[model samples]
Target chain A: MVSDLSVLLTDRQGQPYSLTSERIKHLEYLCESTRRDIVDTLYKIGRGHAGPSLSMVELLISLYFEELRFDPSDPKWPDRDRFILSKGHGSLGYYAVLAQRGLIEKRELDTFESLGSRLQGHVDSNWLPWVELTTGSLGQGLSYAVGVAIAAKRQAKDLRAYCLLGDGECQEGNVWEAAMSAAKYRLDNLLAIVDWNNLQGGVTLEVMPSLEPFALKWQAFGWHTIEINGHDLQAVLQAYHQARQTKEKPTVIIARNIKGKGVSYMENKVEWHGGTVTKELHQIALEEINARLSELSQYADEKYGRNHG
Target chain B: MANWKKAPIREALGKTLVELGDRYPQVLVVNADLRNSVKSIYFMEKYPDRTIEVGIAEQNMIGVAAGLASLGFIPFAVTFARFASKRAADQISMSVDYCRNNVKIIGAYAGIFTGAQGVSQQMIDDTAAMRAMPNMTVIDTADVHEVRSALLFAAEFSGPVYIRIGRDEWPVVFDETYTFELGKGRWLREGSDVVLLNSGILLPYAVEAAELLESEGISAGVVNMPSIKPIDAALINDISRNVGAIVTLEAHNVQGGFGSAVAEVTAANYPVPIEMIGLRNEYSESAPNDALLEKHHLNPPWIAAAAKRALDRKNRLRC
Candidate 1:
């Protein structure tokens, strides 16, 4: 059944996202394809953050493909929902998703960190106009996101602001200051998602100043907290929807992610956070990811109708 | 308005901001609990809805202002100069400057020894610190009139601006006809012997020193350089050509403040014998304005002495 694709997939104002077998299958394809592109690109680039980039693949896929509303053609469209990549080292993953939407060109992707590549090591708004906030330093994006949300509300516009921050990024005092102000303003339209990968520079959170009582901390800051497995697409979508409906307060989704997810050897390996993906290891990782594609595709078709041939 | 009636520069900022709000609907103020002291409270009283109280968080205040600027609202983020420069430097660099967000950062009680708030509060590095950041326009108005003009200038001007203002009521230097032009300096007095180029509240001293030099047969010119960064190099070059000696002044460290900018201008083109008059590579003590000014040789008599020293160096260079 072909449905009208014009309405935004974000909220009740648009066609709210429902979990059908075919839709889930398409989202899963996007997730896996995004990971493949990232791994491929990072391999070519010779140097990049792979683990943190890999950890947030599903989240970015869910945001760009289904939840966050935007027109790729008119990127600077006023009233378009804004997204802040506060965890700026995750630029490769962001660039991959943006490329899928065809926002970033192939040449730009090839020249990722090299000269003339608009895509800097960190997210740069000067290079990418729609980047919203060119973030690299942690704990600042949520404040920018809150400001955006405040501006939207003041203008009586329905556009929302979303920020994706690393687990380690939350340790910044600015984040809590932003959190306190966001709560004070009762910014219902502002949603922050923490990539709770439990690692900072390959060290466990326990060793670092831990975000151990993380959820309660947000709760204490008067935020509606949603804890979920970061890799779970269904829970991710549900958390986003709940956040949109929540009023009189801001919402935070503590996506407990693995620093290096998906590929067997890389998964949960702290060292892979900054380690190089050799050509030998790249091939093995691709095969591991490739092996799951057909099985998931068949299972999706068996459970529900097919979205594509 | 009395010609020399001392009024708070922050008050001028607050009053003018309200006028800006009346005209520009997109104008907003982001305060970190310094409204009463910084005098953004005037704008706050007039437009409470437009004022965003971030509650004493400087970094978050800047980020929020950037966010607002991103969405087309012009946000004036106000905080003490020291906190804004040092505490939120990275945020200003990453979120505002690098992103090219059109936000106005008001640094209050900057480099003023009269603050009594302690040496920690009096910031001598705000100009030096902000001047280093790319895409930041630094403006240090000398009085109420210039502060008023600066607020008007900042509203119409696009991109990031760092405006240094004083917390307490201070002396007025400019008249009613005074208008602000960024990247330009107004030559207040024409003296061939020596010229004192200065910005912020120290312009009166420069003028008084120039008058004192005239009595001593020393033609001392005075240049009000409000636009600190992207400084008027041509004016400095022209003035340097006419004058034998030059003195650059600010309530900041001579290392990277107003003096360094003037020296860079002349150094690049026509190198001149410049005696930079400022805090002599040291921290300022929390004292009365008169004591600090007198102690630091920033008052008129000391300024005249410095100009003579510069003249002596110029004479020595000729010899």
Candidate 2:
């Protein structure tokens, strides 16, 4: 099973654009299934940040299924690309992707936030090997990614570091500090993705109105900035490829997306940012995600055949 | 009184870091834009490729250190104790301590040594704040020798460590033969009537106070406690049991510092009368180093007076 994954994930030419359409369709299906898992896990746990997690599904799917290099059996594989979830409250999406990638057992998703569970409320590296750092007290993950990138460059390792942050977490002063240093060091191997759903605890506008011209802020910090619709798989993939091609500077993708992207009642709803899902709502969410997954799988079968050739 | 050889604590720290950098290839230095002040510039000069400058971001410095640690690198992050403890406390707690990263956090200009820099620069609450953190080994070095030994110890020891060093020149208390052991207090002088518990740049004052107590026909024992978190409870208990009275001195606030740590140990193990001589509850203004010490009642005479008061209280308990 691991060998099959390695064969599929190995980029012979080191270009993600060389991936087949079948692989992209398979990744799209995996993303839908991951969304279902996230909703189900949060509903079972009785508490979680559903809105933020839902918003980051496609971005994580792109990284885990298409961009990142790793052996699910050997998570500590040296030279493998690294990812740090700076906005760690969105761990539901992260854990779902990890499970889907076989880095963690799928059944473990049921134990999230439970007693003695590795899946804590926040990302804890001590509890899991795949988690690179303990985060949740926002704005620290990007700096950590910068450190990893620096180490990779010093060692001349063929590796890259990616960090995912929330749009709300940009308010933290440490983020800009890391941004400045990464650019100053010309860490071209580092990438930062901001989930620009634009709503924080309340609306980001209501909480703090200063984040406008966000991409320009990254540009001002000397980063190569890319703006894309986060929910669009093709745009996310293209942005990542562009980031890889850029040299002598760090890159940040301001992925504009909706808070609760796939669910009908939860979409764009502030209440779902960190609220418990009722049994009825959970059922509705699962039905919607399952429908999407079925549509994606059928499309892949019809377009690329059952073997995804 | 003979004058002792003195040197700035930062120079000793820089020298030791360079030595460690040579000995351990994985040893790295992370500075938060205070390279000149923290003396990490020396390390940067020696190993240009090994030094990481995070600019004025203490929080980012700590997080980066943790990241390096996760990759099995020994990253010593340097910044003012004031900022390292207060400004980046959350990162230290969550990113480093919680994750059990082998990151050495070197907090320079701890206590009242940042004298003219005023209360904002001074770190009176660092020991307390770092001690309260789980999986954090807190060490406050006394002299240049101890500073060198402490940095060496931090380089070898795994897990999170917060080492506090002062900026001003301090009297050399230990010789070249001095060895540093984590979680063990060093006994400098021996007496029976009272115990002078001290740490950091204030050790010279405690030694002076013990001598003063001797001239006054009082027997005072002096012990230097470098490790503040896993404090030498056995030594503190023995001193409390044998001496029956104690006087705790530090350049930090009396609350949640060396004094508070000793008091807690004695209160739980051996309930002996202890007098804590430190910043009672006020911030130090921008004054000279000596003036700051004098204003905070941290001079030798004040330490001797506090020892006498503890002895008097011990005598009163008999009545």
Candidate 3:
């Protein structure tokens, strides 16, 4: 159930664009559609990371549709802004966003995790040109992002590098090593967003109770830290804008997210972190997403006229 | 013998990196707090802007190097072989090798070269670990000239490469006129009875062993196999068929080092009796370089004895 609703498009030059209430509704609708796609894709594969992928839908939609600057037709453009999915197990959401952006054929989404499919179980750049780096094992993405940002600084390019990490992935020592180096290089061109879903593999807090002081740890690493409700479209958008304004240091936005935002049964459930989605569960999840999509469309039509729909 | 000048591979690496800095404008050197020890300091001195010092963090250094490579910058990530191959192996596998990033991993103090630092710092199994990774090109520098050439080659080559270098001084195996090529072994001395195949800092010892064998009427051949992966299979096949026996020496463990690489090639192509001379599936203690080499039976006399043993095995099979 794709919608023909058009939102304001930002220019390739990364010029400022106004986000109206109608556009926010459209973004939310898009996020809902992405959730449906994630469920359907995982249900077909019979095995995929459901919780992490579902939680990352809004963040991915915001970046691809609203924040990132690039021509979908030419994904390998040198001057294009880069996005690295550090928590690559959430690639179902990433693939859905890529399909929605028209970067990949929408039909190809069905081939995900299948033999020889470009959309591998984990993110692999070799299989897909849109992916900047191959990542599956956690905590390495920030370092790669730092290198890209350093390159942007050296070449005096105005491009910025963004990485989306998971809260659980932060337990990796390499993430901090990357954080220290990102600050040491004064990588103002770099921005990172951590999906603080609070549940990692098996209840993260139970596994490592010490992860509580997460935001302070990033601040101590010399990053410009911002905390926000990740699902709130407006707050997530504002965090992106604020990060761009920050200078002479890297910025990290700790987006407080639910493990599974939209679906009822999967929310905050670690078992859904990685599992095979059955047909009944898939239908239920799709119905939940579809219901939200319809509500968003009705709100957009009533508030901003039928043309907005 | 007295006139032959010895140069530390680390110094040669630094000098070659500076030369590479001049040649490839996009070349970036990444260090994991071992700049001076790994010889990355030379590149840091010349191209300060191009050098990234990630203090004592090999995992992050490799990830950052992979990131730089993704952006079309050729990054040479330098650290001790022990740390780079062991501590940061997963990062190297995922970030550099799997991604096929053009990151040159210069693993300094490879094998038993970290003498005073003891077995913990020694990387006897790094060759095995690095070679095991798909899309990883493993190179062990034989001498000062080879280390220079290996750096130059790795700088120009576009892929993930692990260049292993020793910490202490080594006798020059190749002169200025010698040219280096990837995956091609060089023949130092040719004989028909037995072939002395070696790599890394042990190449000179192999040559000395060959000389000792010659005096003992053993007519041994010496070949230096620098490229562990994409190894000189043709030379190995030729030696296996014609020479009939082989003795492989390295300043590494025999399990997954140069010897195992040579044995794999010979076992698959031409089955020949082979004797491996190196650390025998065990760790070394803190000692001087000479004592460590002697203890591990990686010295010339021991290597010569191993060659004689292989020759005897070949003769027995013939009988």
Candidate 3 per-residue lDDT, tens place, B1-319, comes to 1234688778888888999999999999988887888778888989999998899999999999988887789999888898888799999988889888899998888888674888777888899999999899999888888888888888888899998999887788788766678899988888999999888888878888888888889899988888888899999999999989999887788998889999999889999999999889999888988888788888888988899889999999999
Off by over 4 Å in 2: A1-20, A204-207, A299-309
Give candidate 3's TM-score. 0.95
The residue ranges of model 1 lying beyond 4 angstroms of the native Cα positions read A1-12, A105-108, A298-309, B1-3
Question: For chain B alone, what TM-score does every candidate structure achieve against the true structure?
Answer: 0.96, 0.98, 0.97
Docking model 1 quality class: high
Per-residue error (Å), model 1, residue B42: 1.8
- Per-residue CA lDDT of model 1 for B187-266, tens digit only, reads 88887888899988788888888888888899888889999987898898998777758998898888999999999988
Q: Write the per-residue lDDT of candidate 2 for residues B1-319, one digit (tens) a residue.
A: 4377898788888888899999999999999888888888889999999999888888889888887776678999988898877789998998888878899998898988774977788888889899999899999888989899989998889889999999887798898878889889978889899999987778899999999999999999999999888899999999988889999988888999989999999999989889998889778888888887788899899999999999999889868
Candidate 3 chain B, run of 10 with poorest lDDT: B1-10
TM-score of predicted chain B, candidate 2: 0.98
For each prediction, how big is the interface RMSD?
0.7, 1.1, 0.8
Question: Model 1 over residues A35-65: C-alpha lDDT tens digits?
Answer: 7777888888887788899899889878876
Specify the CAPRI tier of model 3.
high
Show the colliding residue pairs in model 2: none
Give the per-residue lDDT of model 3 (tens digit) for A1-309. 334333333333546555567667877877887788888888887888889988888888888876787776798999899999999998888999888766888789889988999999999988999999888899999999998999888888889999999988988999999999999999988999999998888665567757768889989999999999999987888888888878889999999999988999999997888887778888899889888888886543333321211
- Selected candidate, larger lDDT, 1 vs 3: 3
